[model samples]
Target chain A: MSALLDSVLATAVPLDRALLLAAVLFSIGLAGVTSRRNVLIMLLSVEIMLNAANLALVTFSKVHGDPTGQVFVFFAMTVAAAEVAVGLAIVIAVYRLRRTTDVGEVAALHEIDYGPVRYPQLEGQPVHHHGSSGNGDGDGDAGETGGQPAVASEEAHG
Target chain B: MTEVLFYCFAAVAIASAVIAISRKNAVASALWLVLMFFALAGTYVLLEAWFVAVIQILVYAGAIMVLFLFVIMLVDLKSEELAVMGAPRFRALGLLTSALFLAVAVFVVLNTRETFVAAADTWDRGGALEVESGSAAGIGHYLFHRWVLAFEVTSVLLLSGMLGAVILTKRRLT
Candidate 1:
């Protein structure tokens, strides 16, 4: 076993191999973020991307024989932790308000007015459809009224 | 032997990452992500970044994943809802875009491999020899000395993040 280990250690792994792995993982994570609809899964994908970056950083650190890259990895991990905490909190809050984690249905802030603006939180109820009358006052009032009920309902649900 | 182990870990990491992203179930995805993290940690070990490898397992595989599992359980998504995806065309477009990105990145790495390796070799030869560069002691010295200010700032970032999370998730402002 010792002899085998020594022989293995004799030939160091190339840096690009690890870098290629990082690239592959990062692309996979990107695909996840784009393809998956679940907000939680999207967040997981972001974590995977961060992990891939960490792998690349560690690999370079090994190659250059510097600890600075490792220190950067430390900071990256701290930021990742903080990001996860805030992100999950937001997820919980969104789940509570919308009763669903589907990213498609949680578009309350989408202002494009794409055909009768379906608010998932206000489902199973009459949505006051104030037609965009091409007047600023009417549109503003409609927007205010549209937002107020969602908040009121959220409070009631909570 | 090390190269073989590295390849094994890399293959595992890539496979698990692909599985983790493609899985419909969030819990299964999170579990697979943990496996990927473990594989990544193994690769880090092979690179002799022992401290980083340990932290990779502890923080990523352990803490962050538990937090993910908690959210997954708390969300309690139904099966019908889990079927949600964007239009098939958009899905295909997204996958195609990422595949293109992967191809470009791999191409760049392959082309620059010799230059990068030669530069790194020169730096290793010319720089002051630090035998414990990947060890915890060496990392700690850098972290607490040269990177101390950033370390303090990171603590501040974490504190703010915790406070923000608390405020965001609280039942009522009052």
Candidate 2:
């Protein structure tokens, strides 16, 4: 018990421990993002990734006797806040219209449809929504920037 | 002594993380994630990065997760879908990439032999234990002196985030 208590006290020994732990957390978050269907849960997994990165930055900063990494972690925290704000807003909008946040349910924005939608199309390739009536109004095209798949493509059609 | 404690927290942190990913219930998964953060923070403290550890708990486990919970509660995502997850190809890719990363990490750890070198050079602890880095004063001095511009920039970023969040959350002008 005392040994456990000793570990509980934070110190450099724990910092190295934290680095290893963060690596594991980072991998688990990666797995969660890959496997999960719920879009919101997937976003949470992204948060886990950011935190894991923070763990690494802070650990190394201390190890090297430098504070620059912590400053970077500060920036990461800020970016994370912005991402959550935008992402959750988008998720709420999609949920309001489609009544679900499941990736499979939002099929109206599939890869096959990518011509008429006003929103940016998914990067790299235009996905044409399968079976979408070719309205030719750009409604068939969906694009996502920054690797976050765009939301409410179904609502755009409905 | 310290090595043993390090391994213990390391194990607990890794286990909680695996549980967080594998748990079926989303809420349960989030809870496990919170535990993982706490354990991670504990690890930070052990490293003598007290400020980072405190900030980790305060910002991540505290503020950020609160936002996540709020969003989870607010969003109704229980409806069934045509597909629950992506193609198995993605999963295979993830596993392959992560396995490669783990192999690299193991190689790096095993090859590096430099654990302790310069205590007498910059520190007088002489292999004795010390909690806070003697450089804390220097950190504060730099933050207030040379890094003031960056500090102000962070304030601007926070302000923008608040406004952006409000604009994003507000109903669109139909």
Alpha-carbon shift of residue B14 in model 1 (angstroms): 0.6
Tens-digit per-residue lDDT, B33-65, candidate 2:
788778777666665556666777898788877
lDDT of 1 by residue, B1-174 (tens): 777898999999999999888777888989999999999888887776778889999999899999999989998988667767767987898899889999998999999899657755665465432557777998899999999999999989999999999988876443
| CA lDDT, every model vs. true structure | 0.81, 0.64
Model 1 C-alpha lDDT versus the unseen true structure:
0.81
Model 2 reaches an interface RMSD of 5.6
lDDT string, candidate 2, A1-158, tens digits = 75674555423353444555566667777877777777876887788788888878876665566676766676687778777877877787666656678776676864344333344343445454333343335544444232222334444456
Instruction: Assign candidate 2 its CAPRI class.
Output: incorrect
TM-score, A chain, model 1: 0.64
Best by lDDT: 1
